[model samples]
Target: MTKKNWNINLKEMVKVGVHFGHETKKWNPKMAPYIFKERQNSHIINLTYTARFLSEACDFVFDGAKRGKQFMIVGTKHQTADAAKLAALAARCHYVNKKWLAGMLTNWFTTEARLEKLKNLMKKKNTGGFDQFTKKEAAILRRELNKLQEDLGGIRYMKKLPDIVIILDQKGEYTAIRECRTLGIPTICLVDTDCDPDLVDIPIPANDDGRGPIRLILKKLILAIRTGRAL
Candidate 1:
């Protein structure tokens, strides 16, 4: 995109409360009444810097996905924020379940090992090995093993480093960030007001703590990716 085009889009995004930064807070009260107005709408309005960061991060993910690069969408919890779901829909990306494999990013080797065990157990059960185990033991083992297998299957979808790691909850995803850093991969995250922005390569400051902002931001990013791809 041309510089002028980018600048125009950025301006428009800012007008819509996309990237309101700390500097904007310095504006005279009369000129910045919208800040307070936005605050009343959501708790994140007070976190202008974070909102700006998230807007840029959203752009980054959209751009990268349009180029056909692989992106991984990970979140703190499953079926909660809708960030992962939006990202997957936009980029056709892989969604990593946030439970059982806590350190899937930082400790991939260990995660892989656990996944192998789960796969083996699944295979054994599939072949009618349930008769060999006591009923209670079989039930417990099956439940735990199935959860692990689901996570493993998600991880297996992206065998190598992704072009970008989009994390919904920074605190909940500490291990994912550590692993991304270790592998020299870039990250895009919705950083809460209290979070350290330096942890992510592309930090979008917002109320990473809430569901509304997360859903809104993620939906925009997915739309951007889909639109860009159509072009």
Candidate 2:
């Protein structure tokens, strides 16, 4: 990582609205320790913790990247989808920007079968094999490919389970969190006040809704991953 990247601080993060959290009424009791206090009926996350935890999470990711770890980027919420997609693309990792499949990680066998179908179809389409088929048959394969691309295009090359999972909104993407937990994969989550930090392996308390903060974090993370590769 660069010397400048190590200096991630609360001042810049606050300018990006990273300190904002859920309303007081929506806050989880378990997150009280990380809460700074309440203002205007909204719970403010501890920016001090945000700076510290986010840096730590970035370092963890860098270390893993150096070890050739594969990550599954997850941010299904409207606020975070773009950040997730950009991070995954920059890091050359798989991502789920749309809805996550129910049994994607848990039911690996069934999911792999579906992925195999996508691969075969892609191969046929690429190799001119599909030209031998009738227009109706070719159209069917094209439709299937388009549908799968919307859902699994980012991860089509993932032959095995990911080594790590990085997510923007922990509370919103609870299903992904649960599946990662089930498989005992290390997870990093941007947890808001309404979320239970305990649920994630590395919890960085910050606002998950705003695109600015998410983009900042994602950019830094991607930088760290790239640094790992160069190392």
Candidate 3:
């Protein structure tokens, strides 16, 4: 099949997935029976639309990367939805770690230093120096360390604004959008029906609320990057 036809088929599959959840009575009654059938239907439509939008956005990312454009992947709260962020990294686009700590984006050198510290700690753990704590303490420390690293990494590429900003959640990343606007960069966003599309240059109307949609979108983008279409 032609690439266009393949894309159309993928888009239709997303629509079907969304339609599956339509009608409160249609939902797996085990989940939340109180919600109206219409609400459930709305949920399905949002998710399906999001999946299709993400798939297309991935194609755009691939094309842009091939042309040597800089893209930024931004998301709020959900690291699992960060498939596009990973793709941008693979494509050599500057990636802002989604868990970036406050002020890290505005202060790159400090963030890099913190990342270095985390790296050193990881190295120490790898080597024989650090004493082994109880599982609880070890787990807690590891978690804290991981958080620190995520925060530091998130803003590592902030010195230069991206040419295009791909935002997974419009409401979640208001600050990121503000920053993008300040830099006059174009934005491509996965916008839920509840969101206003005016904020984004390229708005892919879809459900920005669920993990399934996020996962599907990220997977497609990662695939594109891996295939070298994203360069």
Candidate 4:
């Protein structure tokens, strides 16, 4: 394995509140190893450990991408959704920012069917295929197409289950994590102090709720992925 230098900056992470974790009362005991100290009733994530773990995760993602492994970025929460989509787009990876359908990965056949439907609807609408229908019918079709696009747009091009999944919120995306686990897919997740670190294959302990932290972390990961793909 080659040595890779990471772009994760410890001082920058602290400035963006990435060191901040959930309140002490809400913290999971499993997160003790990553907690630096308690300040103002909240846990402070140990930046040293955060940086180390994040670098390892980035390295893994980069190497995987270099080998043409597919990734799915999952973050449906309001704070992280947009960031997730943008990062995935930048990295050319699949994403699920709007919602996580229960059988998204475990039920590949159904998900593929929905994706095929979405593709057909989009193609028809783009090439004037909708002109054959009456105005009212076209309107109905357009609405359904829009709904499908909003729900499955990110993964429409994904022909199979992803080799890896990057989850933004461990607690909010518990179902997604479980689905990945059930399918034996590896997961790299941003876990707050209140989240179970053991649930993910690679847990990056940080503030999962803040937009700054979320964007910062995703940005780094995307850069690594892009670098890998470019190579």
Better lDDT candidate (1, 3): 1
lDDT of 4 by residue, 8-127 (tens): 899999999999998899999999999999999999999998898889888999999899999999999999999999999899999999988888888889989988899999999999
Q: Which candidate tops TM-score?
A: 4
For every model in order, what is the number of clashing pairs?
5, 0, 5, 0
lDDT of each: 0.62, 0.87, 0.56, 0.92
In candidate 4, what residue range of length 10 has the lowest lDDT sum? 1-10
**Against the hidden reference, what TM-scores do the models get?**
0.65, 0.94, 0.59, 0.97
Off by over 4 Å in 2: 1-5
Q: After superposition, how far is residue 34 of candidate 3 from its true place, in Å?
A: 28
lDDT of 3 at 170: 75
Off by over 4 Å in 4: none
lDDT of 4: 0.92
Note the residue pairs that clash in candidate 1. Answer: 50-205, 51-205, 53-204, 54-204, 54-205
